[model samples]
Target chain A: MFVDFLYELRERGVKVGPQEALTLSQALGKGLHETTLDGFYRVARALCVHREEDLDAFDRAFAHHFRGVPDDALKIAEEVLQWLLDPRSRRELTDEEREILEKLDLEEVRKRLRERLAEQNERHDRGNRWVGTGGTSPHGRGGTHPSGIRVGEGETGGRGAMAISARRRFRDLRSDVTLDTRQIEVALRRLRAYVREGAQDELDLPGTIDATARSAGELEIKLRAPRRSNLRVLLLLDVGGSMDPHSEVCERLFSAAKRATHFKELRTLYFHNCVYGRVYENGSLTRGPRIVDLLRECDRSWKLIVVGDALMAPWELTASNSPWSWTEEDRASGIAWLVALTGHFERSIWLNPEPEAAWYGTAEVIRQVFPMFRLTLDGLTAGIQHLLRGGERSR
Target chain B: MDFARFRGTDAYLTSPELESAVNCALALERPLLVRGEPGTGKTQLAEALARALGLSLIHWPVKSTTKAQDGLYVYDTVQRLYDSRFGDGDVRDIRRYIKLGPLGEAFAARDRRVVLIDEVDKADLEFPNDLLHELDRMRFRVAETGDEVVARERPVVIITSNAEKELPDAFLRRCVFHYIEFPDRELMARIVRVHHPDLGNQLLDQTLGAFYQLRDVQGLRKRPSTSELIDWIAVLRRAGVESVELDDSLPFLGALLKREQDLLAFAEAMHRGRRPRA
Candidate 1:
C-alpha cells in the first residue's frame, strides 16, 4: 500500500525516489504516525514532499489515494473507539502498576500490537487475548494497562482529511505561474560575473607562501582584491497606458533587480510604450535624464534589459511627426532611439510580459531591434543566459 | 541514548503538524529544514526545541559572504603570520590558531545541543550542498591538525531559510522539511493573548478583524506578517485606541504596513470600495 502511494506521488509529478520511500517506512516503523490515518498524512507529507511547490501535487495524490477508508478499516476503527470508551476499564492505577507500565518500552508495546493484529483476524475474535477492550494488554486503549499507547484516538475524520488536503495552500508558490520576487531574484542571479577588482584587502595565501619562499625564509604577507561581481544592469521599464495590465510583473522584476546584490550596479529608468528622447528615473514618468547623456555616461559594458508589452501603433516606433514627441530629438523616430540604445549596449534583450503567440505589430519590430523573450521563468532564464553570452550590437 | 521529545515551550506555540515534523526529524536524526515567510518565527523553533529538551542552543547566523568552510574551522593563517613576525606565542603549533566555528563547537561539545542555521539561503546557492557531508556524518576533519571532531551525541540541527534561493535536491532529500503557515484567527488570538494577556476581547476581535481585512487587500506589495500584527496590537493598546475600523482611516497604519507603496495600495484599495466595511 505504501509503495502504491509512492507510485501515485510520482504519477502526479512529485519527484519522490526510493530513498524517500525508505525514510517513510522507517518513520512508520518507529510508530511516528501513531497508527492513525491523519498521522499518516502528516508524516507522509513531511517525508515525501520537500518543496512547497510540490505540495499541491502531493495533496492531489493524497486525496486520490485515501479518498475514503475501506469498510473493514472503518469497522475496526469503530471497534477500537468502543474499546477506548469502555467505562469499566477506566480504573486508576497504583504507583507500582504505573511504574511497571512505564517500564514497558514503546517499541516493545508496538511489537506486541503487531503480533496481536496478525494473530486475530475475525471481528468475533476480539477478546482479552488480543489487543481488545478491558484487557491487561499494554497496547490497546482504555485497558487496565497504565501508560498503554493509544491506538487511534483524536483521529481527524475522513472528510476532515479530505478538506485539509483540498486546501492546496501552496498553489501560488509553483514556478509555472507568474514570477514572484524571489523567483525573479533567482533568475537574475545568473547575471553575476565575478571579477577581481578594486583595493587589495583579502589575504592571498598562496601568494604569501610564494613570496615568503622567494625572500629566503623571511615572512612576507600578500594581499589581493576580493572577487566581486562586475555585472552592471540598466533596466528600461515601460510604465503607464497599455502597460497597466503588466505593471505587477514589471514591478516584481524591478524590485528583484533593485534588491539583487549580485550586480556591481543596477540603474532603472522608465519610458512609456517606446523609448524616445527621455527616460524617467522614477516610475511616475517625471523627466530625469536625457537618453543621449545616459548612453554616453553608461558605456557598452552595461547590460540593458527592456521590459514592455510592445503593443502600440506602428507610428509610435517610426513616425517622425508624432504628437507624443516632447523634444526636437524625439522627432527622430522611436525605432531610431531604440536602435541607438541597443547598439550602445553590446548585450541587450527585450522581455515582453505578453505571451509569445500574441507578439505581433510593434512587438515584432522591437524584436528586430532587440531580441525579445517572454517574461516567464524559462524566458527570463534564457534571456539572462543570452545576456551572459555577449549578443550582437543591434544596428 | 534516550531522546526527549520536544513539545513547544510556553512562549513559542507550534501547530501539531510542526510538532510532528520536529519529532520526525528527531526520530530520523536528520536536519529539519524550516522555510517560511519572514516574521513567522522560523529561527525561534530551534530555541524553543532547545529549551524544551533542556539543551543549550548554538546559533550560526548565515550571512551573504559566509562560506561552508567557515562553519567548520578557520586556519587563521594571517594571524599565524602576524604571531610569527611579532614573536607572541609559538607559531609552529598550527592548532593553536585554529578557531572552531559554530558547527565545529556543536560537534565537539560533550553534551547534545540544538544548532540553528538561521537564514541559510542568505549565503551562496552552494552553501547548503557544501555542508551535506558534515551534516550527514555529524563529524568534520580539521585540515590543519588532521584531527577529526566527532559528535559525542548528535546535535539537533534546525536550518531555516527564507526561500530566497532554491536548495539543492540532494541536500533537500536528507532533511525533514516543514513550512510554517501563518497563524489562523483562533491561533492568532491565542498567540496575541500570549503576548498581551490583559487585552480586552472586544479590542482584540476588532484588531484581528482589521488586520486580516488589511491582509486581504489586493495588490499589497508585502502582506503584514504575524510579528507586525503583534506590534500593531501593542501600539493600539499603548495608545489606548479603542476601536480599529478598516475604512478611509486606519489608526497606527505604519505599524502594520512598512512600505510606502503598500500604504498607497491599501488606501487605493479602500478608495476602490473593494472592502466596504459595514
Candidate 2:
C-alpha cells in the first residue's frame, strides 16, 4: 500500500525515490505519526516533499491514496460496524425509530458516521445525540442536521478527505506560474564574473608549500587576495506611462538587481518614456544627474542594462526639438543619446517588457542601436551571457 | 541518554506542523532544513529546540566566504610556521596547531548538542554538498594530524535558509524540510502577547489591522515581517500612544517599513484611499 502511494506521488510529478520512501518508513517505524492518518500526512509530506511548489501534487496524491476515512478514525470504523450490527442495540428501538432504522442501508453506511457512532455510545433515540435514527445527530440516516454527514450514503465517502487536500494552500508558491524576485535573482546570478582583486589576506597554501620546498629547510608563507566578482552593473529603468502595465515585472527585476550581491557595484537610474538629457536617481524623478556627466563618470567596463517597452511617438526618438526634451543644452535626439550610451559601454542590452509579438515602431528602431531581449528568464539569461562573452566590444 | 521532545520554549511558539517536523527530524537523526521569509524566527527555532530538549546549542553561522572545511577544522599553518621559527616548544607535533571548528567540536563533545548551521544558503552553492559525507557518517578526518574524529553522540542538526539561493537536490533530499508560514492574526497576537503582556486588545487590533493593510499595499520592495511588527508595537508603547485608528495614518510607520520606497508607497497608497498600482 505504501509503495503504491509512493508511485502515486511519483506519477503526480513529485520527485520521490526509494531513499525518501525509506525515510518515511523509518519515521513510521519510530511511531512518529502516532498511528493517526493526519500524523502520517504530515510525516509523509515532510519526508517526501522538499520544495514548497511540490506540495499541491503531494496533497493530490495523499487524497487519492487515503480516500475519505478520517486519519484518526480508521480503526474505529470496524469496531463501530460491529456495534451497529448488534441486534441487542436495535431491540430497544421504538416502532417509529425502527421504521427510520429500516430506511438505512446497513452495508452502505459512511465511515464518518461509524466513527461518530463509536464516539457516542449511548443510543439517544431522540434529541440530537447518539447514532440512533433521530433528531439532528450528524451520524445515522434520516437526521435533519444541516450539512451533516449522512450515514447509509456510499457516494459521499471521499468528501471528508478531499476537503483537506482541496484547500491547496500553497498554490501561490508555485514558481512556474509566476516570476518572483527570487527567480529573477537566481537568473541574475549568471552575471557574476569573479576576478581576484582585494587585500592579500587569504592563504595561498599551494604557493606557500612550493616556495618552502624550493627554499630547502626554510619556512615560507604566501598570501593572495580572494576572488571577487568585479562586475559593475548600471541599470536604467523606464517608469510610468505605457510601462505601468509591466511595472510588476520591472519592479521584480529592479529589486532583484538592487539586492544582487554578485556584482562589485550596482547603480540604478529611472527615466520616463525615453532617455535623452538626464535620468532620475529616484523613482519619482525630482532630481537627477545630467546624461553627459553620467556617461563620462561611468566607463566601458560597466555593463549597461536598459529596461523599457520602447513604445513611444516617433518624434521622441528622432526630433531634437521634441516637447519632451527638458533643456536647450540637450540638443541630441533620444536615439542619439541611446546610441552614444550604448557605444560607450563595452557590453549593453535593452530588455523590452513588451512581448516579441508586439514589438514594432520605436521598439524596432531601438533594437537597431542596441540588442533588445524580452524581459524573461530566458531573455535575462541570454542577455547575461552576452555581457559575459568577450566577442562584443560595443553594439 | 533520554531527551524530552521539543514542545517550544517559553518565549517561542511553534505551530503543530513545525513541532512535528522537529520531532521527526529528531527521531530520524536527519538535519531539519528550515526555509522562510526573513524575520520569521528561523534562527530562533534552533535555540528554542535546544532549550526545550535541554541540550547545549552550538551555532555555526555561515558567511559567503565560509567553506565546509572551516566547519570541520582549520590547520594553523601560519601559527606553526611562527612557532617553529621563534618558540622553544617543539613544532613537530601538528596536533598542537590543529583547531577544531564548530561541527568538529559538536562531534567530539561528550554530550549530544543541537548544532545550527544558520543561513547555509549564504555560502556557496557547493557548501552543503561538501559536508554531506561528514553529516551522513557523523565523522570527519583531520588531515594535518591524520586522525579521524567520530561523534560520541549524533548532534541534532538544524539548517536555516532565507531562500536566497536554491540548495542542491542531493543535500535537500537527505534532510527533513519545513517552510514556516507567516503567522496568521491569531498566532501573531499570541506571539505579540509574549513580548507585550500589558498591551490592550484594542491597540493590538488597530496596529495589526494597519500592519496587514500596509503589507497588502502593492509594489512594496520589502514587506514588514513579524520582527518589524513587534518593533512597531514597542515604539507605539514607548510613545504612550493610546488608541491607533485603522483608518488614520500609523503612528510609527518607520518602525514597520524599513525601505524608503516602501514608506513612500505606503503613504501614496493611504493618500489615494486605494492600493497603489505596481
Candidate 3:
C-alpha cells in the first residue's frame, strides 16, 4: 500500500524518491496507529510528501489507495481527472443562440432563480430549473443558462455568464510563485513618480560646510526635513489557475508595486481572472471585501493598475457564475463588476500578461471594457504614459 | 507535561486537533512544519510548545539570503588565515575556528531542546532541500576538524512558513504538517480575554465587531490580523478609552488597518455614516 501510494504520487508529479519511500517504510515499521485514516494520513504525509503543492497530489493518491472502495470513488475520480485534464467544458449552443441568451433579461432570470432556490431541496446537476453543472439550467454552471444564473462553472469558454447565483471564496493559491526582480524593476522604473511627501530632520551637509567655513571654523549645523516621494498606487492582481502561468510576471508587478520607493502608498489586492464580487488583501485569500464597498471607500485619486492575462472564458465576464467559485448568489456578471471598478477609479488600466497579438476573441471583449496594455516594458510605459497624459481626465 | 497549566501560563490556546497533531509529531520524532498567515501565531506555537514541553528553545530565523550551511556551523577560515600570517597561537587547531550555529547547536546539545526554524520559506528554494540529510541524520561532519558532530538527543524541530515559497516535497516528507487558520469570533474573544483580561466585555465586543466589519470590506488591500486586534485594544487602553463607539473607533483604526487603502476605506465608511454608500 505504501509503495503503491508513493509510486502513484510520483506519477502525479510529487517527486517521491526511494529514500523517502524507505523512510516511510521504516516509520511504518515503528508502528503508527492506522485504525484512523487521519493517523495514516499524517504519517504518510510526513514520510512521502515534501512540498506544499504536492500535498494535493499526495492526498489524492492516498485517498485512492487507502480509502474503502465505493461506487462514488470512480465517479469522483473521473470528475476530478476531467477537471484537471480540461477545465473548459464543451458548449452545445451555437454562437447566435449564446449571443441571444447574452442579451436576455438577467434581472428576470435572477427573480426566477430565487424562486427555484427556495423550492429546490436536493442537489441537481445538468438539469433545468435547479443549480448544477453541465445542463441547460438557468442557475448552474458549465451548461446553457439563457437569461439564467451560473452556479458553479469552472472553465468558461468565452460564454458570458449572465449572473453568478452562488458566491464562495477561492484562495489565490499561487502565492509562493516568485518572479524575477530584474524585469519588475525595469517595468516599475518607467512608472516612477517622485514628490516630497513629508520632511524629517536631516543635516544639510553642503550648507553646513559652507556656513562653517564662512563663520571662521565656528561649529555650524543646518537641519532640514528630507524630501520623500509621494506616489499612491492601488494594484489589483488576478491569481488562480488561469493566472498561474503568468504568476512570475504578476508577482513581479506586485512586489515592484510594494517595493518601489516612489510609491508612498501601495495597496495590492488579489482576484481570480476578473474582479467579480470581491478581491483578497493577501495571497492566501482568507479575507475579502465586496467590490462595491471598496469602490466607494477607495480614494479616486489613487492610480489603479489591474494585472491579468484577460484570457478567461467569455461567460466568466458576461455570464453569472464567478470565475472564482460556483456558489449560489444574486450577483452581477464579472464584466459588470469590472465596469463599476473602472468607473470608480478613473485612473485605471488593465495590464495584460498575454501578448498583444493574442488579444483576439474574448481578450478583445475584455479590451473593450478595460484599456488593455501588455505587461512588458513598452506596454507598461505606454499605459503609464496614457495615465499621465490625462486619458481619464474627462471622467 | 501539564498542557492545561502551560496553556493558562502562556495564554496560548490550541484546538484539540492542533494539540493532537503537535503531540503526534512529538511522538513520531518528526519536525512539525507549521504554515499560516502572518500574525497567526505559527512562530508563537514553537515558543508555547517549548515552554509546555519544558524544553529550551533554539531559534533559527531564516532570511532570503540565508544559506543552509549557516544553520549548521560557521568555519572561520579567514580568522585561521589571519592567525597563520601573524604566527598566532593555535593556527592549526580547527576547534579554534569552529562555531556551531543554531541547528548545529541543537544537535550538539546534551539535553533535548525545541528548535524553531522561523520563516523557512524566506530562504532559497534549495535551503530546505539541503537540510534533508542533516535533519534526517541529525549529525554532520566538520571537514576542518575531521570530527563528526552527532546529536546526543534529537531536538524537537518546529519549522514555520508564511507560504511565501513552496518547500521541496522531500523536505516536507520528513516533517509533520499543520496549518493555523484565522481564529473565529469565539476564538478571537478567548484570545483577547487571555491577552487583556481587564478589558470590558462591551469594549471587546465592539472592537471585535469593528475588526470583522473592516475585514469583510471588499477590496481591502490588507486585512487586519489577530496581533493587530491586540495592538488596537492596547492603544485604546493607552488612550483611556473605555467604550468602542462606531464613529469613535475610526481614529483607533490605525492600530488595526495597515494598508493605505484599508485606512481610507474605513475613513470613508465612517464619513458615510458607518456603511459604504456604494
Q: Which of the numbered candidates is closest to the native, going by highest TM-score? A: 1
Please give the TM-score that candidate 2 achieves against the real structure.
0.63
Query: What is the lDDT ranking, best to worst?
Result: 1, 2, 3
Best of the two (2, 3) by lDDT = 2
- Alpha-carbon error at A125 in model 1, in Å? 47
What is candidate 2's lDDT per residue for A1-395, written digit by digit as tens?
45456656866778675468557766776667767778888888889888787888999999998897666633533433443455433322212233254464433433544554444454354223323333121122233222222233332322221221122212322322245676687789888777778899988879988888899947688899999988889999999999999899998998888778788999999998789889999889988898898988888889999999999999999999767567899878999999989988888999988878878999999999989988877678788888878424432
C-alpha RMSD of each candidate structure in angstroms: 14.3, 15.2, 19.3
Please name the candidate that would achieve the greatest lDDT relative to the true structure.
Answer: 1
Cα miss at A8, model 2 (Å)?
Answer: 9.9
Tens-digit lDDT string for candidate 3 (B1-278): 31222231357888644664575567667788888668888888988888887889999999987898998899876566556556689876889889999999999998998999999978765688888899889999987777888999888889999877556555775777777768999999999998999989899998898888777776677788999999999999999887775563465778877888777776776677635544
Ranking by TM-score: 1, 2, 3
Instruction: Tell me the tens digit of each residue's lDDT in model 3 across A136-177.
Output: 222233333322211233213123232332221011111112
Q: Write the per-residue lDDT of candidate 1 for residues B1-278, one digit (tens) a residue.
A: 23567678888998988988998999999999998889888988999899998999999999998999988888888889988878999999999999999999999999998999999988976789899999999999998799999999899999999987778778998999898998999999998998899999999999899999999999888899899999999998889899888976899899989999999999898988854643
Give the range where candidate 3 chain A is weakest over 10 consecutive residues by summed lDDT. Answer: A167-176
Clashes of each: 0, 0, 29
Tell me the spans in candidate 1 whose CA falls farther than 4 Å from its real position. A2-19, A51-64, A70-190, A193-200, A206-224, A237-256, A270-274, A279-289, A307-319, A322-324, A349-395, B1-3, B141-152, B164-173, B185-278
The sequence of per-residue lDDT tens digits that candidate 2 reaches over residues B1-278 is 13357678779999878887888899999999998889899999999999988889999999998999999999888888778767757899889888999999999999999999999989975699899999999998898777999999999999999877767778999999998889999999999999899999999998888888878988899999999999989999999998786443678888888899888887777768744532
Model 1 Cα lDDT, one tens digit per residue, A85-158: 55222112112232243464535544544454454444334434333431221112222122221223322111
